[model samples]
Target chain A: MMGNLLEHMGVERDRLHFSWISSAEATKFVDVVKEISDKVRALDTDKKFAKDYTK
Target chain B: MDTCIEKIRTICADLLAKGKVQKVIGFAEGSIPMASRPIAVTSKEDVAKLVFNATCGLNLANYVSDVLPKEGKIAVTAKGCDSRNLVTHMVENQVSRDQLYIIGVPCTGMVDKRKIAALFEDEITDFIEDGDTLTIVSPQKKEKVSKKDVLRHNCRVCTHRNPVVFDVMAAEPVEEQSLDQPFADVDHIAAMDPAARWAHFQELTKNCIRCYACRNACPLCYCPTCFVDESSPQWVGKGQDKTDINTFHFLRAFHCAGRCTDCGACVEACPMGINVRDFTRKLNKDALELFGWEAGLDMEKRPPLDVYSPDDPNDFIK
Candidate 1:
């Protein structure tokens, strides 16, 4: 629900990743991390919700 | 509607006189026109002060928890939306059903005071409703407008015009509106690109003064120590910073996921005229489409967001 709401508010849907992996499945975890990293890298670095106090 | 008020007053008076309830939470005439404030009547005489009108926009459910007596029961006059909120409170354990005597009023939507105000050149001095027509009197002139034309945005799209649960109904149920596009407002924003959607929200909340009126007005926001007040881990800043405003609105709406009934209390309470429902309406649409859930309908069933089941959708999780 949080992911969907964030996406609705204009955040990139790919920025948030949800997964379920057993603790024993180390290889699955690694693959999920790699997939998430690649998706994050593909998107431009725009912190729409981030606060810059310098302003 | 006049008969509805008389019935409500008679019922509340009887309850108070019979010692069935310690107080009756209802709306009374506000100091200004087009604003009926909530009142807690303790005596039979005070029941006459109760009134039900389109100007009574504030939800009575927001007061149920606060006005509830420790040892005695209380009666509340509820509209369709307010009754739904009362159910939300009971489901959340903030209030018990046995301790409440709900006097239900079949709602015929509330008027948008802003819309009526916009039509007048001077301050509105009086408002009179007769059937489907409203007589709005200002210092300059009197204008007759149809009640349907000035209906509150949420009320215009409301599907529940009758109370889901009530001890006694003041009037018979009215016809409920069935809309073809209940979430058209949310879909409009969803159609925008990510950047545009962000900009839309930014502009929507730009006039916010951080007054927290929306939080105070919402029946769902009953946390004893709200996230914003937590200094140790303040979830939102106190100033009117854009990011802080956005964060506050986002977190607040998120907290109401699966719980909000789209009562429009937050929007009614907003002094800046911000349509705070823009955030919650999206969640309401998601809850309906994804979970087939509309909040505050059944007290026995737990909210979808708070429960887990094997049949629950997991497509969002990889």
Candidate 2:
């Protein structure tokens, strides 16, 4: 379903990432989220790639 | 016995006739012998089939999210664990408390059908439930086994015995069990070295087909738009790669965090025999230890992740 939604919205597959982090590994979850955020920020170029992705 | 079935039918009939509930979700004898599955009864004629016994282990609370009423309340049958799940949903504000009519049953403990199947090599022709004792009949032989012997492992140490929230209870409430030694396996895993732990996880998750049975079975995973299914930002890849499978499972476990009630339904539903409870149990332990909170125990309490504390411990922060 996520795949279909992304396809319909014309979002590139490489832009998305997911990870599993246990509750004990709070650092790991934070790190992974930070990494994803950095990657997403980097992808944000001069061209406005649909703002709907912010949510 | 037959008395309980008659009483259930009468209650359902009255509820339907008075327009109290539009649907009554309970258990009916399944197509397979010695098993019962969740059924939705809309009419009084179908209510006579409602039965409650040790074999009704499937959490009917999971159906609340699946079946939403259009006009009136939905009547649901719940055992101890199922009631806790309903409380969890209410606490999380997923479902309004007023929208449900709960028929709570005091659970002795439900039998694990998979464990019973594993005990016998031959096909089970029939079974009888006499109080807490279960008698199994096969073409070759018949065996009587104590219900405690085959009860689901989670039920053995369950702390919640009474329905946390119920509109009408069917039986007297049972005393809660002491959970002084909860999450023993989580401690064992935590004691393991990083390499060995990763190896163990790889072995468990390597065979995952990404069926989403774990997510579907969980009562807390009632999100209409799960992050995995969110395509706007594409949180997870859709490929069948082992890494993707691992990612999906991990993200799901994280998403459940403080909200997991340790029902172990995800582990039971997983076809790959993955120890899904290990991750969830670890989260449950963390929620209790770090925040001094237990999910589903108190409907008034908010989930730990739902609210943040400025002075919250961040040992994980680098």
Candidate 3:
């Protein structure tokens, strides 16, 4: 179910990750989120590329 | 007392002998001096080693998830509190109801060892129970304490004296108590100002070590693939920041809002002095009062959060 959801969201198969975090790993959880956000922002989503893809 | 033991043993033996069940998940005496942990019995001969007493307080229901049986059934011992956990799992569609053989016991509440030890200044060598009165023999002195005084706090207000859902009941069912005072702490928290409440929660969760004891102790948290472990698009980080800790706790509490059975295992398992039960109990009360939903009360009832009705209130959007 999680894999299907990730796929629908256009998440890369290689970039997909899974974890079994507990309440204790709060800091670790936050860092992972931040890292993901950074990676997402770093992706080159130029308008020309977007138009070409749409076309 | 022997009748109860014999009955449990007979059921286990028969199940194992007939290939009805592959393993019997029950409590066994730990090798450590004072620890009594949950153990799985595979053979019929090991059934005799199983013991149920005042000290058998640990909810064995959590072990059901740990030992995943591929095909055959597994027999588990359930007190009133433990049975609720099983119901919670069934309600959430975590486990198939038909796969389990529940041996329900009408609990009179188990003793809290920590509370008992606090009563005596000296070290307790051994303790014996003669009905309600527990005789504690210590190196310094021997003292007899009434069971009422040393009972676990949650047990004092426990309404589920009899198993809510069970296959084979070991004893006669006890009367269920009223839910009059179920949300005393929740009311107390509600009375506080928003700032005060935020401060209180901050203080409580700040001490969390992210041990996952609360998650592990929860019977309903049987997700084979939990959201916290996702890496491809990590939901939560692996750092030790206070904000991250608070978020994890908040998310967890929200996730368990309608599903929590209020078994009090998470609070007990927590090493830090965090009152994890407060939020869970509050959520339980909210579900009951707002939606008229009580979790783990019936096997057939669908989880309150999982299904939505056309008439459901949209107060948040409005």
lDDT of each: 0.92, 0.74, 0.71
Error of 2 at B73 (Å): 0.8
Worst 10 residues of 3 chain A by lDDT: A46-55
The regions of model 1 sitting more than 4 angstroms off are none
Best by TM-score: 1
Q: Which of candidates 1 and 2 reaches a greater DockQ?
A: 1
lDDT by residue (tens digit), candidate 2, B71-107: 5699888877888888888887767888899887777
TM-score of chain A of each: 0.85, 0.56, 0.46
Best of the candidates, lDDT: 1
Clashes of each: 0, 2, 27
Cα lDDT of model 3 by residue, B266-316, tens digit? 766777757777666667776777678777788887777778887654443
* C-alpha-based local distance difference test score of model 2: 0.74
Docking class of 2: incorrect
Off by over 4 Å in 2: A1-55, B1-6, B230-233
Question: Can you tell me which runs of candidate 3 are displaced by over 4 Å?
Answer: A1-55, B1-3, B32-34, B121-123
Worst 10 residues of 1 chain B by lDDT: B233-242
TM-score of each: 0.98, 0.80, 0.78
lDDT by residue for model 1 over B1-318, one digit each (tens)?
878999999999899999999999999999988889999999998888898998888989999888888998999999998999999888889999999999999999999989999998899999999989999999899999999999999999999989999999999999988999999999999999988999999999999999999999999988999999999877778998888999999999999999999889899999999999999999999899889999999999889988997888889899
Docking class of 3: incorrect
**What is the Cα-based TM-score of model 3?**
0.78
- Candidate ranking (TM-score, best to worst): 1, 2, 3
1 or 3, greater by lDDT? 1
